[model samples]
Each structure stands twice: as structure tokens, then as C-alpha cells.
Target: MLSQFMVLFGFFALVLVSIVWINKAVRMFDRLIGDGQPAWVFVEFTALTLPGVIGVVLPIAAFAAAVYVVNRLSSESELTVMQATGYSPLRLARPVLVFGVIVAVMMSLLAHYLIPGSLSQLRLRQDEVSRNISAKLLSDGEFLHPAPGITFYIREITQTGELRDVFLSDRRDPEAPVTYTSSRAYLVQEGGGTRLVMVSGLAQNIGADQNRLFTTYFDDFSYDISSLVSRDVVNLDEVAFANTLEMLRDPEAVATRTGTTYGTVMSQTHGRITAALLCVIAALVGFCTLLVGAHSRFGVWRQVLLAFGLLVGIKIVESIVVAPVLLNGALWPLLYLPVLLGLVLSGLLLSIASHPGVWRRLMGRGRRSAEVAS
Candidate 1:
């Protein structure tokens, strides 16, 4: 059961993560490739996002595999034989517990190390790519949108890398829209900044506030384009990308970089630890729920549905707890409630399954009373 659960979990997680990552990567290709990035850049971006996808998929996969294996065993009567041979529910759960622990360890590794490292590298690569104009962001005879509300078009490119008939539109400031057209232009790299040097050009500005148009023609012109694209790595500093140890050691710094509260950083750091525990809880929940009733000849489909229901309830509780915890750090401990609830429910279900006599007697008494009333 343990081995099967592990194999199934790995398979499902891989398939799920691949589908999700590829879907997202397709959307990214539209933006990144449209900005003139190469195909390899898209591949690299998708690769860097994979660890986070795996981390998100692992726990759910473990639960699903555990439920499927348990249902199969119950349907096959193997679980009944073991029970008749004096195997308690708790005893039968040994393999599942081991499976859960193994999955938990994998989740811990991803949460603490792999995910953070991948995200950090992803951010750095994205920042570097965003800053370099020569890297991408230019194509002849096509309109290029370097940033929001900013567009550039070049009619032709010369052998010496000069631009002929260049047009740029900047609407970053909604109150004033600026348009520049030039007969000849050069993209000059200087002092870690990119500048558009235009010769024999005209600048047109439409001021919405004044409701008027202003135009200027010049022999020579220059526009600083460093602001058009992100030039610094700071643009990539999100809380999800920060190291767990770093968040624990210096939450204040994390808050500053991520534009979030110190409490939010702490919640995120501790949330990773708690999420790993939930993976174990998820496995146990699936395994124990199937032990709640006697073996069914029709198969354990009811128990399978019950197990999924329990998992959904636990996830709902997790979602409910997250908001309060993030809002106030004082409520951070509540994040473990869902895990605790799962563990408690699993223990109760296993206990009941082990001592079916008590449950049978109670049901018998209730049926007898109902008959008397009728």
C-alpha cells in the first residue's frame, strides 16, 4: 500500500504540475516572446517555475493516492482478512503512517529549500531580462510593447544596427500622451542605461487637462528609456521568493522588500512548516476514513467519497484560518487547527473501526427504540 501510494502520488503530481506549468508558460510566451525573447528564454522561465508547482501539488497527490489504495484494499477483502486476523485499525495504519511521513519529508524539503531557491533564481533572471533592451524588446516592422501603455515601432534596420523611421508612443501618464516620430534613430547603451537618440524628429504631446495638443520639431533629440523597462533586480522581490531562514531571521527586511507587514512575512514562513504537517494529516485522513465501516461487497466507493469530503472540509478550514492569521499575527497558531482536526478525526475513526462491537450495540439499541415507538 505504501509503495503504491508513493508511486501514484509521484505520477499524479508530475502530470498535474506539468499541465499547470505549461498552461501558464503559454500565457507567458505571449508576453515574453511578443517582446522579442527567444524560445529558450521561455523554456528557462517555465523550468524555474516548476519547483513551486510541485510543492503545491504534492500534498493533494499524496491524499488522492492514499484514498485510492485504501479503497482498493477494502474492495479486495484483503483489509477484512487482516482485520479478522486481529489487526487493529491502528495496526493496519502502520504502512499508511510511514507513507505519510515520507511524503511529509519531501514536502519539507520543497518548502524549505527547493521552492525558495527556484523562485529566487527565477526573480533574478526575470529582473535581468527585463532590464536589457539588447536582450529582447526590439523587432523591425512590428509594433513592440515594452511596458504597459508604451509602444515602439521601427520600419527598417540598417546593416550597422541603426533604426530607420522609428515611432514611440508613451501614455504612462494618462493626463499627457507623448508621441515621438523620427526619420533616423539609434539605441545607445551608456552607463548602464538605454537611450533613444533621434535625429530629424518631431515630438507631439496631448495634454488632457488643458485639452490642447503641443508639437515640437527638432534637429536632434534624446529620450531616457531606462524607466520604460525595469532596470533593477528589486522589481522581483516578492515575499514568496524570499528564503524561509531569511524571513525568520529578518522579517522586517522582508516586509520592506515585499511591501507587506512583518506579520505577513512571519505567517508565510511558518505557513510553509504547517503546510508540510498537513500533508501527513491528509494521508492519514484518507487511510482512516475507509476504516470507519465494515467491508462492502459493492466496493468502498462510499468511504472513498467520505475521504474526499473530509479532505475538502479540512482544506476549507485551512482557507478560513489563513485570512485571520495573515490579518493578525496573534492568530498565527490557528493555522494548525485544520491539521489537528484531521488528526483527531482520524484517531476517532480508527478507534471506532477497531471496536466495532460498541458501534454495533449502539446502532442495535437505536433501531430497537425506533421499532418500539412505531
Candidate 2:
């Protein structure tokens, strides 16, 4: 019961820490965009995203907390007393594993379903913000540089989506400068991009020998002012989410267009399976670590650090295994190696914990050191 409480408490604490840390990291990038949005907007964004981060961090943190709590109990000889009262090591490990399984199932749901849905919503919100210029985002008599190489200067923006004393300059062309002026303009989305629907505007072109000018008096005109940047086309299957059954079902249509290889697809599929298995293996590893180090003088912090290191190492190995599938098709089997290594390590830790000789040696070492000091 105590072990279960420790696991639950640790999961929540670690998840909260992960949310704050990730939010802090994302804000640094958000500030660069100069959106003039409040910090609370970013905080809300981070809060909505906490589940995804928790899904990834919870399993590992639960593992570490279990190890720390169990090891501390054993080191203080509390576990010894429990054993004297007929509580077996396996019996102690059961509650920890049960807690780990519940966390694993929850994380699996987040990773496979909830995270993707939240990410899609985030994209839509960003798109809405980008395409629509809110009055709140604008300040009177201040130049706004919302997108690269595009600047807008306005004396005031009215509540009815009208700009006064507006000046627009687009420096995308170095050889020829394009300058435009309008008494009023409104924001609009066209052709998957944002455009300024300027009315009663005149455009001027500056050249070496002469200046070319054009004036238009129309009800409405559209000027391309899109801020959206094109991204490099990476193979979709390389991403973990694309490996889902729903995605794979329409592979012939979607897969070929994504520019991904069969090996890359296979690796991504295996990676998801491996990730689910990792939760179980981490629990085993944590339980064993606690039991083997039961009599150690080191505090829980050391075990926490060690568990974090192990989790990081496992993630690194997972990436390394997937890299081969991206580079060479023949090395697809290498993706399985991380899961195999995790299993082996978990088994080894369990063995070390169970062996009578190993415990005897550890106890003997403590006795010898005490005797020498005496």
C-alpha cells in the first residue's frame, strides 16, 4: 500500500515538473515570434499540453520513485522487519508492478490518441491567430513586424477591421523595392495564405533609371502577405504517430506521397510497440534496483539520478536503432535491439537482487569497513 502511494505521488510530482520545465523551454521560442501575447496564453497552451508530456515522463519517474522508496525502506532495515514478518520480496514488488501497469496504460492512451488530438488543436489555434489580426495584437502608432520582411505601420486600427494612415513595405525583393500605401486595409486569407485586402491603394516600384508607379481605385484588392513558412518534407512514417493502424491502413495512397521507405515504416511500427513494453521493463528494473541496493548507505536521490540516466540511455538507443532504418533498408532488424537490451537489463537486475551470494557480499563489505574503522 505504501509503495502504491509512493508511485502515485511521484508520478504527479514529476508530471508537474515536466510541464513547468517544458513550458519554460517553449516560451523562449514563443518570445522570438513577437506576437505581443500575454504569458497566460502560453501558460494555457502548456497546461493543455501537460498530458502529452506526462505520458512520456510518468513511466520513468514512477520507476525511479519506486526504486527510491523501496531502497530507502530496505536500507533503514524496515524491509528486513517486514520480511521477518513473512512479507516476501516478490510480494513487495507486486504493488509496484500493478501501479506501473496502470500508468503504462494511461500513457499508452495519451501517446496514441490524446497527444495527437491536442497537437492538431494547437495548430488550428495558431493558424487562426496568424490569419486574423486582432485589435488586441495591434498598438496605435507603432510599427508591427508580424512576419519576416513585411512591416505594417498604422496610426490606428478601428474595431470594424479598418486601418488608418496605413503604410506597407515588402522587402522580399532586393533588386526591386515594392512600396504601397492605402487609406484603409483589412486582413483576409486566400490560397492557404494571409493577404491584406487593400482598397484605394497605390503601389510604387523603384528602379535605377526611373520610378514606375501604378494606382488602382477599386472596391477591393488582394495583396499576398502570407506569413506561413514552408517546411521540409520529411517522411511521415519517421514520426511515431504516423505508425498507427489507421495511418498504415491507407499506406499506398499516403505512404508513397510521404517519401518514406518500407524499412522506415516498419521501424516506426516496431518503435511504438517497444515503447509500450518499456514501461513494464522499467518497473522490473526499478524493483530490482531497490532490492539489490536495499542495504546501501546511499540516499534515494542517487537512485533517482541513476534511473533517469537509464531512461535517457534507453531513449538514445531507440533513436540509434531507428536511424539505420532511415539510412539503410537492410538494417531494419536493429530496431528490435533496444527492446531486447531493456529485457536483458531488467532480467539481470532481477537476478542480482535475488542471488543470496550477492547480498552476502554486500553485507560483508559493510562489516569489513565498519571493523576497519573500529
Candidate 3:
């Protein structure tokens, strides 16, 4: 059973990861390809994002595989034969429990190690790519919207890489729109960001509310493009990029380093731990929820749906727990409530599956008492 569970888990996990990876890759391609990036760059960037995607898909896949495998066994009468052989529900679930533990350990490794490393590398690469403004952002005869409310255009690019007839419009401030036109400009890397140094440029500012326009002419002017492209100040790290050990070792220091709070850092550290444990809870929920029902030739569609509903409920509890924990570091332990609840629910389901005759006898007695009363 453990072997079967592992095989099914791998199959389901691969299928889900492929679907998610494709969707993510398509969007990433659309964004990077438009910036004149090469096919290899596109592929590498997409590949770097896979570890984070796999971390998210692992638990869901484990649950799905557990439900499918358990239902398949039940439908084939294998589960019934095992029960007849005096195998209790808890005994039958031993293999599945081990399978869940294996999945949980894998998830822990991903959440703690692979995801953070890959994501951090991805961010650094993205920042590097963004800093190469001449190659990525500037294109001759094309209107480019690098950021919301900002548009740039270059009429021609000289062999020396100088931009000719540059036009820029900034409408980030709704009340004031600024437009700049330059006869010539050069993109220079400065202070870890791209700067457009324009010569012989005229800047025009229009005020929407006051209905006023102001024009300024200058021989040289500069504009920074890093903030426009959503690139963090180069070398600045975020909490998400920090490893679990770092975050846990000194959450306060991590918070200070990442420009976040202790609550956020501790939440992230504990969240990763609990997120890994959720894989085990999800597997148990899927297996035990199905155990609530007796065998049926028609199929266990109802039980499958019930298992899904339970999983959803657990996730809902997780969402509810996250908000408070994020607000207060002291509430970090609340994150594990969903796992505890799942264990309790799974235990109840196993008890029901184990003593099917006891429940039937109680129902029969109730029916008899009702007849006598009537």
C-alpha cells in the first residue's frame, strides 16, 4: 500500500506541477519576450520558478492521490477482504500514514530549503535583467509601457547605442501629467539602476485640476527607471528570500534586515513549518473521510466530494489563522490549529469505519423504539 501510494503521489504531483508550470511559464514568457529576451533566458527564468510552484502543489497532490488510491482499493473489494481478515481501519491505514509522513518530509525540505533558494536566485536574476535597460527596455520605433502610467518611446537607436528622439510620458500622479521630449539621450547604469540622461530636452507638466500647463527646457536631464520596473533597490533582501533557519534564529534581526516586522518574520518561519505538516493532515483527511462510507459498486463520488469539502474547510481555517498571526507574533502557534483539527477529524472517521456494526445496531434499536411509540 505504501508503494502504491508513493507511485500515485508521484504521478499526481507531476501532472499538477506540469499544468501549473505551463500556465506560469506562458505568462512569464509574455512579459520577458516582449522585452527582447532570448529563448534561453525565457526558459531559464521559467525553470527557476518551478521549485516554489512544486512546493505549493505537493500537499494537494498527496491528498488527491490518497483519495484516488483508497477509493480504487475499496471499489475492488480489496479493502473489504482486508477487513474480513481482521484488519482494523487503523491497521489498514498504517501504510497510508507512512506515506503521509514521507510526503510531509519532502514538503519540509522544499519549504525550508529549495523554495527560498530558487526564489532568491530568481529575484537576483530579475533585478540583473531589469538593470540592463538598453537591451531590455529601449526599442526603436516602439511605444513601451514599462510600468503603469508611464510610457516611453524611442524613434531610433544609433550604432553607438545612443537613443534619438526620445519621448516619455509620466501620468503616475493623476492630477499632474509630465511629458518629456529629447533630441538625444543615453541610458547609463548608475547606483544599481538605469538612468535615462537626456540632452536638449523639453519637459512639459500639465495640471488636470487647475487646468494649467508648465513647460521647462534644459540641456540635460535624468530619470530613474528602477522604481518604474518594480525592481527592489539592488542588494536589498526581502523576508521571503531568507532561509528558515535564518528567520527562526533571530526573527527580530531578520525582520530588521528585510524591512519587515518581527510578527511577519516569525509568521513566515512558523508558517513554513506548519505548511509542511499540512501535507500529512491533507493525506489523512483524504483517506479517513472515505473510510466513513461502506463499499458501493456505484462508486465513492460522495465520499470523494466529502473529503474535498473537509480539505477546503481546513484551508479556510488556515486562512483565518494567518491574518491574526501576521498581525501579532504572539499568535504564531495558531497556525497549527488546522493540523490538530484534521487529526481529530481523521480519528473520528477511523472509529466510525472500524465499528460499523455498532452504528447499525444503534440505528436498528432507534427504529424499533420509534415503532413501539407509534
Task: Write down the TM-score of every candidate.
Answer: 0.81, 0.69, 0.78
In order, the Cα lDDT scores of the candidates are 0.85, 0.64, 0.88
Residues 1-374, candidate 2: write the lDDT tens digits: 55554655476657676666676557744662356455665665665567666666666666666666666676678877887798766676677677667666766777677766666565555554445454223555788765567677878778886777678777777667677787888877566666777777777666735555545455556776544333333223334445367545654444465567666666655565566667766766666555654555555566556666776787789887787776765676787776687677766666665666876898799999999999
| C-alpha lDDT of residue 161 in model 2 | 63
Q: Deviation in angstroms for 233 in model 2?
A: 15
lDDT of 3 by residue, 1-374 (tens): 88889999999999999999999999999888878777888999998999888998999999999999989888998888988999898998888899989998998988888888888888888887875666556678899887789989999988898999999999999888899999999988897777899999999998787898999999999988767765457764788889888887889888888898888988899889988889999999999988887778888999999999999999999999988888898889898899999999899889889887898898799999999999
Q: Flag regions of model 3 displaced more than 4 Å.
A: 145-236, 361-374
Which residue pairs clash in candidate 3? none
Candidate 1 structure lDDT: 0.85
| Best lDDT among the predictions, by candidate number | 3
Ten-residue region with minimum lDDT total, candidate 1: 228-237
Output the number of the TM-score-best candidate: 1
